[model samples]
Structures are given as C-alpha cells and as structure tokens.
Target: MTGISGGGVMTERKKKYGGLRSGQTIAICLAGLATLWISSGAVTQTPDKGAEESRAARGDQKILVRVRESVSQVRQSYVTVFGRTEAVKKVNIAAETEGQVIARNIMKGAWIKKGQAILQIAMNDRGAHLSDAEAKFEYQRLAYASATKLSKKQFQSRIRVAEVLSNFESAKSELAEIRLDIHRTTVRAPINGYIETFPVGVGDYLQTGEIVATVVNLNPIRVVAHVSEREVTKLRVGDKARILLAEGVKREGEIKYVARIGEQETRTFRVEVWFSNSKKVIPEGLTAELKLKTARKHAHKVSPAVLTLNDEGIIGVKAVNKDKSVIFYPVQIMEDTNEGVWLIGLPPRLTIITVGQEFVQVGQTVRTSRDEVELKGNSTDFNSVKSAS
Candidate 1:
C-alpha cells in the first residue's frame, strides 16, 4: 500500500511540471512577435523624417554661377554702319560751241577714250565762209608777189610797193580769223570712261557749254563712310579695310582720306576708302559695309551666356574657387565677336560650370556632382579625364 501511494504522487508532479513548461513556451512566442512589429514601425518612420530634412536643406541654398577664364589672341571689335559707294571720278560731257548736232557716233552708256570726238556739229554757212577765206588768201598772195617783183625791177615807187604789201597782210589776217570761227563746231569727250547718259541726239540743237552726256570712270571705286569722334583716333591714312557689298561680295581696300573736320549736322567725320575694280562688277551708289582692321591684342574669349551682372550692376564673370565657392570678377570687354566676347580679366586657367549655373549661391556648400562640372581649358591636346568631385 505505501509503494502505490508514492507512485501516484510522482505522476501528479510530472503532469503539473509539463503544464507549466507549455505555458512558458506560449509566452516566449508572443513576446517575439511584439518585438518584430515594433522594429518594422521604426524603420518606416525614420526614412520619412530624413527625406523631409533633405528637401528643406535644398530649398535654403541660394544663387547659381558659371566661371570664365582669359585667353590670348588676335582680337577685333568692329562697328557696323551703313555707307554708299561712289565713283572715284566723274565727268560731264558738254558742248563747247553752239551748233546743230550732225553726227552722234557715241551712244548713251558707250565707253569712250580720252580726247575722243563724241559728236559732230554742222555750222550754218561754215562751208561758204571757209571757201571765201581761202579765195581771199590766194588773192592776197598773188598781189604781194607781183608788187615785190616790180619793186625789185625798179618799175614801181617804194611807197606804192609798201602800201600794197600792207594791204595784202590785212586781207590774210581777216581770212585766218574767218577760218578759225568756222572750225568751232565739233564736240569731244574729255575723259576715258563709260557714258552714263545723253541729253541730246543727232540733229538736236545744242548751246555752248550744254551738258550732252555724263561719263564715269569705273576702274577705281570709292566708298564713303562716317566715323564717330571716338573711332577717329584709330583710323589713319592707308589703313587696310574690307568693303562688303549688299550682294554678299567682298572687296579689299585702303583708307584714302580721313576728314579733319566733323560734319556739321551728324557730328561725324567722313572717311573715304579706295578699291580697285578690275572686273567693274561693283557699280556706283551701291551700299557697302566697311570693316577696318585697327589693332590686335591678347584677350580672353568666352561665351556671352556666361556673362553676368553683380549687385552694383557691373559687368563681370563668376569664378569658382578651390572650395567650390563662387566670386564675381569685373572685366573690361575688348570686343564682341560671332564666337564670343573678348575679355581682359581673370587668369588663364580656370574651372567653370557650364550647366546648372543659375541655381547655386556664392557661399553655399553644395553636394556637387562630378558629372555636372565640365572643365573648359584652352588647349588642343587630348586629355584622359578621371572622375572629379
């Protein structure tokens, strides 16, 4: 009876210990699930807060910048002006005597050589006057001959012979004057050039000193331009220049004259340049642009887009420092060309931002991306670039 009682107690204790062990296992599983849920919630909340802080920081940053450096080269600054071309020399053909135009050998627009006869004038009764003068001269010569022979032979008095000789000389003088008056009928050209116009045709009556035609010498052309007082000092006689026509043709020339006095109305000095027209393609009165090559110097050529104004409204360029901070540097513009502007400030070597230059401030620290910065150096040599920050 004592042994059976002891066995029953051991079985009861085993059952109680098993029930406590099962409860402990269930409690441990519930605690682990709660821990996992709390960790996941923290992971989601931390990222949202970090993203908000990053956006706020980006909004606070100010100013955008680009940098430019200087270079040495042949630079020129040209001013465009409207001008007209003219003939180097022009002449008007006029009638020298009053008469009817009998022959007009040269037509309008015809080219004539110097001293060429352009028209023939028929003088009314000129032929009759010339014949009468010739007859009287012959008569005078016969009378003078007879008187001289008789005086040598002592058949006439000395006084009578001298009086006849005087009469003969007077008749000859009158005849010569008549012949001269008849010869003033033909009109001539005074120069070698193309006839620009003709006011009278054949058979038309013309007066003395009447304009018959206009002639222009087209071998050498002249371009007339005006220069301001500021540019007058840069121009000198014999300076090389270029003449561009409206038709896209270009001709080379040299400055021939620079007026000493300024124009009364425009306040500009007149300048004349001469160019040879071998082909005669450039006509008179054509509009042209004159480009004068004045001087060349060392300068920095940069894109006009990179230029900016400072707080004081001074023209300058932005320069980047070693710390990626920007600073404004004032520059004197030497010239503005089709490619870029020639400037006179800054060092020869520099790193400038080409893209996104309008977004960053002067002193703000930016997380600069190496891909955004392009180093524009003046060199033709090849470079193997590595990533930069």
Candidate 2:
C-alpha cells in the first residue's frame, strides 16, 4: 500500500507540471500575436507617412505663380518727341526811301498781300521836281533831234551832236530819278502775310532801310523737333506724323524736312513737319509733341507690374515654356499708355508671369495659376488669379 501511494503522488506531480508547460506555451503564442498586430499597425502607418513626405517634396519642387496667356497683336510703332511750332516764313519790311509818313493804310496786325501799300510818305517837292524834269527832257529831246538831223545832213559837227545827245540822256535820267523818288513815297508789302509788328505810325519820319513792319506767314505752319540718330534714319520727307498742341489740339502733318547732318552740340537731327494753318490760329513757339510712326509690328500689351529684370540687369518679362519651365525674354517698350505698356520683341504667343515673378528664377520649373487678360481698345486689364490648392 505504501508503494501504491508514492507512485500516485509522483504521477499527480508530473500531471501538474505538464499542465503548467501547456499554459506557458499558450501565453507565449498570445504575446507573439499581439506583437504581430503592433507590427502590422506600424506597417500600415508607414505608407501614409511616405505619402505625406512625397507630397511635401512635390510642393517644394514647384513654386506657385500667376500667369497670363498673351497673344500679340499688330500694332504701329511710333517715335515720340517734344517740339514746338514755328512759322514757315517771316519778313522784316524796311523803308525803301527817306520820307515823312503821312498816312497809314493798314492796321498794325492786318493781313496784307504782296504790293499792298502799308504806309504813304509825303510827296514834298517830288511832284514839282518831276514836272520840271519832264519839261527839261522834252526840250533836250527837241534839241537832240534837231542836232541829229543836221549831223545826218553833214551840216552839224559830230562833237556838237554828241553834246546834244548827252544832254538828252542826262535829262532822261533826271526824269526817271524824280519818278522813282515819287514812287518810293509809298511803302508796300513785300509778301503775303500778317503784320506781326508795326513800329512806325502816321506822321513818323523814316529813313531808308529802316524797319517799318514785320510780317509773318502762317498759311502752312511747321513743327520743329530734334530726333536722335537712331530715329532719324527711319524718317522720310513724306512720312506722316501727328502733332499734339496746347489744349489737347491734335493736327496731322507731313514730314517736310529731315536733317542729313546732326547738330554739333546735341548730336540730334532736326525734323520739321508741315501742316496747314489756314485760319492762322496756330501761333508760333507753342509747345508740341510729335508722334511719328516708324513701323507696324507684333506687340503685347501688359501692365507695368509685369515687368521684371534678369540677373544681367536686363529689362524683360518672365514667361513659362511648354514644359512649365521659367524663361526670361528681353522686351522693348513700344509705348506707354494710360491702360498699359506695349511691349515688343517677344514671341508672337507667350505665357507671361504676372505675379510672383520676382520670386522665381530663370529655368526653374514652376506651377502656374492662369489669370484672364481682358482687352478693351488697345488696353490690357489683368484679372486676379485664385490661390492654388
């Protein structure tokens, strides 16, 4: 009975140990499964983190900017210059003979034609002198005729006939002098123009070669401008130009003269444009602006805000290529208007960066948001672009 009890106790202890070993195996498996679930959760979050990192890298690569798709239009290029109006011709009328002024025919500012009498000088003894000279001329003519008849008949000596002929010529010269003196008493206009100044009036004594009046012709007025050497070569004598005068008055004129040589001091060529002033309303020395069309070209109109400078300090605009790479194109300002600045020397079609151009660099890849460019009568208006998401 002692042997049986010892064996039972040992068997019972072995069973208990076996049960403990099974429980330990189960706990180890459960711990392993929990570890696998945690690893799977980490693996699941890895893809999200990688996606976030990828998006952040992409956002850093491209810079957002506003752009405008530009289509160049045909435009006329012009060279503008400041100038002033000038009279075509001016004359200073002088007295031809010494006399006392008796009557003034025209007013100080009257328009007079050629040969119109301006002032009348007193005759004085000119009429009496003319009559005396005429009588003497007739007497000498009769004596010369008698002597010539006698000389032809060989009855008078050659010396006497020569003397008589000399007397007749002398008297004829005297009569002509008297007639000329009488005629010179009236001062006439030398050209068809308006009298700008009349220094002398009625009862004013005048000497020969004294200034009596100043006449200026304004039928075809002229605008005189100085142009640079680069612009002078494109101008022709028949080219048309527009002139802006005081009070916003604009007139069309034809190029009349362009200097072949430049001025020594300023190195500028002189240009003249002629236009009609039929009413004589346009005065001389008035300020003017000349707009001379040089040529027709393709141009794009953009706001001044779109202009930028390159690394080399060149004035240009930033554009995007087909591949969305930033590009710099040098541009020349064709004109500046109230609406926008017209730019030339650009591609016929372009995608120009409007905003955030300064933040970008040449040859850099960019993301662009498009803005609308509205056109209204040669003016460009840019609409705001929305922020990129």
Candidate 3:
C-alpha cells in the first residue's frame, strides 16, 4: 500500500511539470509569430494603407470626363398636335318635286359643276297643266280687256268689269305655279362638288323634300383639332400651321377658327385650319398631325446621353464649374428632335460633362477632356472651353 501511494504522488508531480513546460513552449511560439509579423512590415503597413485610402477619398482623387461648352440660343419652336381633317363645305341634295326619277346624270363619286343637272324626274302632267293654265290665262286676259273697253264706252257696268279683271289675275297665278313645277323636275347641283352618296336610283319615285344625294366641296379642306385650355389661348385666326397626314402627305395652312367655349368633359377647345385643295386629292375624315409655331425663345440643345439625375431625384445634366467642380442644374426640355433635344434651363455659357458623369457626384472635382469645335452663332454664341490645367 505504501508503494502504491508513493507511485500516485509521483504521477501527479509529473503531470504538473509537463503542463508548465507546454505553456512555456506555447508562449515562445506566440512571441516568434509576433516578431516575424513585425519584421515583415505587415502589421504597420495594413493600418497605414487603410488610413491613406480614407484620406485620398476625401477630395484626394479626381474623376476624368469628356465635356463641351453648350450655349442657349433663341430659335423658333412649334407645338405639335394630332388631329383629324374635314371638308369645308358638305351638303345633302334632296328632291324638290314629287315625281318618278327618269334619269341620273352622274353616279356617286363623280365630280360635278355648279348648276349641273344631277338627276331628272319625269315632268308627268306638269307640262300639260302648264299649257292648259296658259290657255285659260290668255282667254281671261282678252275678256278683261273687252270688259274694260266696254266700261270706258259706258257699254258695261263697273262691277262686272272688276269681276273679269279679278278672274284674269287668278288664271295668271295658276300658270306661274305650273311653270315652276316643270322647272323643278330637273334636280341641279347648287355648287361645284363631288357626289359622295346617291340614295335615289333611276325609276325610283321620290316624295318632296326626300334626300337624293350627298355632295362635298373639297376645293378647300379644313383640319379640325382640339387644343387644351393651356394651349388654346395661343391659337388665333390666321395663325400659320403645318399639317401632316397619316399617309405621309404634308400641307401648309392657316387657322380658320377657334371655339371660344371649351368642351365640358375634356376642357379642350376646337381649332380649325384651312388650306386650298384645288386638286381635291386630300379626302375628308383623314387623321392628321398639326404643328403650330407658338413663340420664339432662347433654349439650349444638348445630347440626351449627357442627361443625369441628382441626389434629390431632379433631372438635369452635370456641368463643370470654373473651379473644376460639378454643378447640377435642373433642366426644362422644350423640344426633342432627331438631331438633339432643346432645353430651356442652363447658363448662357456652360461646360457640360459627357463621360464619367455617373462616377462622380455633385460638387466633386473632375478632370475633363475638352472638345475643340463649339457652337457659334448670333443669339447665344459658344466660346472655347477654359484651360483644364
């Protein structure tokens, strides 16, 4: 038992000594690792690099970009609206006399001249009535003359002569009525136009005031359009406008009318533009686009690629200030054409950044590549860009 106890105590001392030695070796290995890291310059170099990068970010680096000097100019601009075309004069022909249609002079879609006969109705009994009335009128006229002559000679009473004169007047009125009926048998066009529709055909009997055909005068065509209340006030009679048809035809015209009152539902007023259609090639009810020159103003034309948005969600293009810092100016676009868009807000002379705008923010310093050629003219002339040194 004594030997066993002694062996157990020896085992405990051995374990304690072994633990101390392992701890000392671990401390020595850590010290070696620390010394190696310091000698390699990694510990000092890492923190220095982070500090250096932070300082450089604070206005230490410059972004490079391409820029141009854009200037605003006074130019003529127009307001374009899509609209529809209409005829200046449209009419419907109707039958004036009750008769059977014996002949139709022209078919629908035929051009007609003023006073040309369009249709002929049978004069049936009208001609015979006129002849009989004329004969009665002649007989009454002779009787009245004989009565007047006898009265003057004291051969007839005044009352009897007066009665004969009255009969003569009544017969004359009947004859005139019959003649008018015969004239109305032939329906004639009132104006020079084209027959749009013909409801009546040959041999068809028509009552008085029944529609016969529809005619449209196309010598002068009018384009009708609706303009909102905001733009209606700028339109006036005699203002020039350009009309473009959907079929790629273009016509120049002038404003013919503008409605004073606006439509209740849409709050838009009607406008009519008139132009000569001597050839009558343009048909009615065609869709058209109208462009009316509103007013002249100073504006800047810039490329669409240069446009950008600011932090506040405002749309504009960034420009380089004299100090090489970015300037964000809000822009109001006036017109957008194939060449470039015309904008209204910008300094008279501005250095606009084109490339690398997305990489920079407002008030950031930038290095710019300048273009040699610039806009030069009368209203708002462009000058050479300042030196980028």
Candidate 4:
C-alpha cells in the first residue's frame, strides 16, 4: 500500500510539470510570432527611409532651380506699319485742239514714251490756208516797204503806210493760227508710262481740252502708310524700310516722306516709302506692310514669359548672381516681336531664372539648370534640364 501511494504522487507531480512545460512552450511560440510581425513592419518601412534620404532637406529644397544665361546680341529694331501700294504718279492726256480723229494708234494698258503719237487727224484747208496767208503776207511786206520809203521821201500819205502795216500784222497772225492748228492735229504722250485708258478711237472727234487717254507711272512705286504721333517722332525722311505686299512680293525701299502735321481725325501722320518698280510688277491699291528701322541696340533676346511685374507694378525679370542667388532687375524693352523680346537695362552677362523664378524671392540661393530646348516647341522639362556638359 505504501509503494502504491508513492507511485501515485510521483505520477501526479510528473503531470503537473509536463503541463507547465507545455504552457512555457506556447508562450515562447506566441512571443516568436509577435516578434516576426514587428520585424515585417520594420522591413516595410525601409522604403520610406530610403525615400527620405533622397528628398531635399527643409532649407536646401529652396536652393535648386532652373535658369537661363542671358547672352548679349546686336539686334535690329523695327516699327511695323500697315499700308497700301500707290503709283508714283498718275496723268491724264488731253486734246489740245478740236479735230476729228482720223487714225488712232493708242492701246489701253500699253507702254508709252514721251512724244509718242496716239492719234491722227485729217489735214483740211488749214495747210492750204497757211500757204495762202504766207504769200499774202510777203506781198503785203513788200508793199509796206514801198509805202514806208515813199513816206520817207513824202511820196505817199501816212494812211497808206499805216494800212499796209496793219495788213502785214493781220497776215502774220493768220499764219501763226494755222500752224498752231496743224500741230495740234496729232495727240502724243507726255510721259513714260502705261496707257491706263484710251477712250478715243479712229474717226472719233475730240474738242480742245478733251480727255483722250489716262496714264500711270509705277516705277519707284510708293507705299503710303500712317504713323501714330508716338512713332512719327522717331521716323525721318530717307530711313530704310521694307515693304511686303499681299501678292507675296517683297521690296526694299527708303522712307521718302514723313508729314510734319498729324491728321486731325486720326492723330496720325502720313508716311511714304519709295520702292523701285522698274519692272512694273507691283500694282497700285494692294495691301502692304512696311517695316521701318527705328534703332539698333545691344540687347538680350529672351522669351516673353520671363517678363513680370513687381509689387509696385514695375516690369522686370528675375536673374541669378554668380553665386546662384536670386536677383530682381528692372528692364526696358528695346524691341518686342512675335518671335522673342529684346531686353535692356541688365548687366552685359546675366543668368536669368527661366523656371521657378516666381516661387523664389530676391537674394535666395537656388540650384540651377540650363535650358533644355525641345524641338520647335516652348514646353520645358525643368527637372530634366541640367546645365550642359
């Protein structure tokens, strides 16, 4: 009985000890699982740490930017004005005498030279009358000479001498009238030009001062434009100009005239540019654009996007110093064009901020990158824009 009792107590102790060992093993497993879960979370956070390492620091983030270097260039400035082409001169050929046009050689739209005959008239009794007047005048002249000699010797009365003198003067006047009529029979061109209109034809009767033809001279064609009061002062006579016609014709010319007085209604002055049109290729009344050179300047060419206004509404651009610190400069526009703007009032050499300029203020140190020009476009990749190697 004692041996049985001892065995039973020993078995009970063994069972309790085994239960304790199992509980310890389970607790250890639970701890191991918790540790593994925590380790997995730490592994997931590694990417965030790496991202933080690559990112810019608090103050240092403000220091990097994209900038462009301003290069000085000699630029030509021009003032563009819209205008129209005009003929140098227009003329009207008129009849000098009354006559019937027997033969007509004029052709409208044909070239004509000075003294070129455009018509012919029938010669009637004028020529015969001219001869008859000359013969009578000669006879009267001889008679007058005889009468004057006789009077000098007191051979005849003074009345006869006076009558002969009157007859001679009458005859001379008659002859001159006939010659004038004969010369006026034929009409001629008075200038070198094109016959714009020829209303008279064969057998057409024309009176004195009647319109026969119209002509125009286009050589040295004129372009007429108007300049505003603000621009007229900068323009002068004989300044260089270029004319672009609507027909795709481009002609170089010089400013021939600038009106001193402004137009009352428009407040603009009339200006004229003369272009050589020896070929008569440019026609009158075509729309034209004239570019007149105003001045030449040493300036920097930049995109118009760089222009900005300060707090006081002063127009300027932002630039960077040698140390890559931001700076603000007031600039005057030397010229503004569709392609670009030429700016003045900056240092000879400048490092202007092209992108992120508005974000930074003056005196701030910023990182910079060069211009990465995309082909034929204005879009920029600022992040990828790094200074050229």
Find the candidate with the highest lDDT and give its number: 2
lDDT of 1 by residue, 1-389 (tens): 89999999999999999899999999999989889988878435435877677556545543333343444665665545558999997998777678888898888888888878788888788788778778877887888889889989998889988888887888788787766656557666777889898888888998888898898988899899998888877888988788889868888888999999999898899999899997877889999998876566566777887777777888877667687776567888876769888887666656554444544445644333343355343111111111111
lDDT of 2: 0.89
The lDDT for every candidate, in the order shown, is 0.74, 0.89, 0.85, 0.83
Per-residue lDDT tens digits for candidate 4, residues 54-140, read 443343344455678788887777788999988988888888888788988767899989899888877767789889988988998
Top model number, TM-score = 3
For residue 22, give model 1's deviation from the true position in Å: 68
Worst lDDT run of 10 residues, candidate 4, spans: 380-389
Locate the minimum summed-lDDT window of 10 residues in model 2. Answer: 378-387
lDDT of 3 at 182: 88
By TM-score rank, best first, the candidates go 3, 2, 4, 1
Separately for all candidates shown, the number of backbone clashes (residues 3 or more apart, or on different chains) is: 6, 0, 0, 4
TM-score, per-candidate, Cα-based: 0.64, 0.71, 0.75, 0.67
- As for lDDT, the candidate ahead, 1 or 3, is 3
Cα-lDDT of candidate 3: 0.85
Flag regions of model 3 displaced more than 4 Å: 1-59, 144-166, 310-314, 373-389
State the lDDT at 171 in candidate 1: 79
The Cα error of candidate 3 at residue 307, in Å, is 3.0
Looking at candidate 3, the ten consecutive residues that score lowest on lDDT are 378-387
